[model samples]
Target: MDAFSNVDSNNRGKRIIDGYTPEPYHMPWIGLLVKDGKARCTAFLVSKNANAKASVWVLSAKHCFNDVLFDEYEDKTINSTSYGLLFGVHDLRFSTQHVIYRTIDELFIYPDEGLKTKDIILIKLDRQIKFNSYINGLCLPDSTEEHTPYEDTPW
Candidate 1:
């Protein structure tokens, strides 16, 4: 038997009970510049994590990635490059202070309708991340869960 088994198990239980969740592995915002169906410019957010890989999905206007080119370009199709999400920003400076995962991979995109501007996107990190400070993951709203808003209204 391992001498630390008892102590290790107790520590694991405490971690869970205290709601210790993984922090956001990626920056909150990312910017992409699409010109002639290719990404040219990029932007990133603050608060970086250094010990893991991050994945980011591009959220853009429907016309950005969709096959809706105007005029004579209507028939042309734009396919994503293999590197796709794995590419990193060129101008963004990455260091121990403002770094989140070393790289990004496995990217996916979802297009939203016109009314809602369905621009929201979610992407998973290529690998697990470790942070210098404690971090908490954001909670997404569930469709089936009951939610109550102020003024006796549920949204």
Candidate 2:
């Protein structure tokens, strides 16, 4: 909510109902998962320690890898042996100085014990990540508040 709050955007003469462009370093935890050369889903940077001076782990939803063993994808043309990660990506149009691309070395997936997206995949990068202003890990809070409708407020 600093300098980038409530900015308006136009999409090719179309009016956007709601849009958001993250400020630089505002959400260092966010990342993009790429299947082969195309983007697929979202990911989040995580750290084992609270301090998080240096972290090597990445987390992404397991559903994103549905086509993994089935032969890359249902198309049968694309063969996905592994997935890629793009971090610090504000815009996907072009690469920026703050942007980084990493190849995944291994994946630790925790499959559902009988639930949807009870799935989480842990990724290990080929190389270690160096923390900077534009790149950092997220330390989840001990607890989070449940969202309730603001029905009591006046419309």
Candidate 3:
């Protein structure tokens, strides 16, 4: 049996704070980072090549790959080949034609930042990901707006 087959999909009260199940395709930028075929962490598409309709970059929390976080593992660094991204799905347990998988090509964590600081990471895909109704990217804020507060920013 597949390791992922045992994944439990039931989540009656596991919403994010006050979040609820969003309509399909409403949050197409969300994705799952799969480590050795198992869901390891959540990520989001932050960039895309408009001309190619393909996403090239994704963002996730840095702790997802930190060695200290996985005390049971002996490896200090994660192997890129062992990871992939699963996109275009609201549910992770089910395999649908709409779900697209892409291998990870590279990982970029912010320099000089520890697990407790910044806590962000950016990933590059092995190949550009073609976008669809269920797969797309969210716009990253421009550098000029980096210091702007988001408390009043409209989503």
Candidate 4:
């Protein structure tokens, strides 16, 4: 049997909050530090493999790459590595061991009109990662609905 066979099928409430550690395979919660010298925001370092190949892509918000001015500049030049995702962050200092996945190609942004959500950014990894690690893949939502509403809400 496959390890993912019995994995959680529900996508809505399947979010996992992991403890920060020095482990390499562990998924570290990340934040973006602006280039003009600003603070960071709440973000997470996610990995995904759209293709079955060994290559993995890191996902984050496009705005996390730089300020909104770059969006108006028409020039696609932006600083990607300016922000660092500190692993095992307890009190701001880099406490736990963390691996900073380098950005291979230009960031890919998902274009959508009506949605106010942040644009999804993709950063390709230099090499392929193992099947099992702290950076595990997550299951996306399918066509099925499995969530229930509160008792007071109308069915």
For TM-score, the strongest prediction is 3
Q: In candidate 2, what are the lDDT values of residues 1-155, reduced to their tens digit?
A: 11111112121232334544546567787877776456677788887766768667888877777656633334322232445677776766556677777767666766454328467777788776777788888775555756556311000
Query: Whole-model lDDT, candidate 2?
Result: 0.62
Q: Is candidate 2 or candidate 4 better by lDDT?
A: 2
- The better-scoring model by TM-score among 1 and 3 is 3
- Candidate 3 lDDT (Cα, 0 to 1): 0.67
Ordered by TM-score, highest first, the candidates read 3, 2, 4, 1
C-alpha TM-score for every candidate: 0.30, 0.68, 0.73, 0.44
lDDT of 2 at 3: 13
lDDT of 2 at 39: 63
lDDT of 4 by residue, 92-116 (tens): 3223333233323345566654236
Best by lDDT: 3
lDDT of each: 0.31, 0.62, 0.67, 0.38
Q: What is candidate 1's local distance difference test score?
A: 0.31
Candidate 3 wrongly placed segments (more than 4 Å): 1-15, 48-52, 68-78, 143-155
Root-mean-square deviation of Cα positions for candidate 4 versus the true structure, in angstroms:
12.2
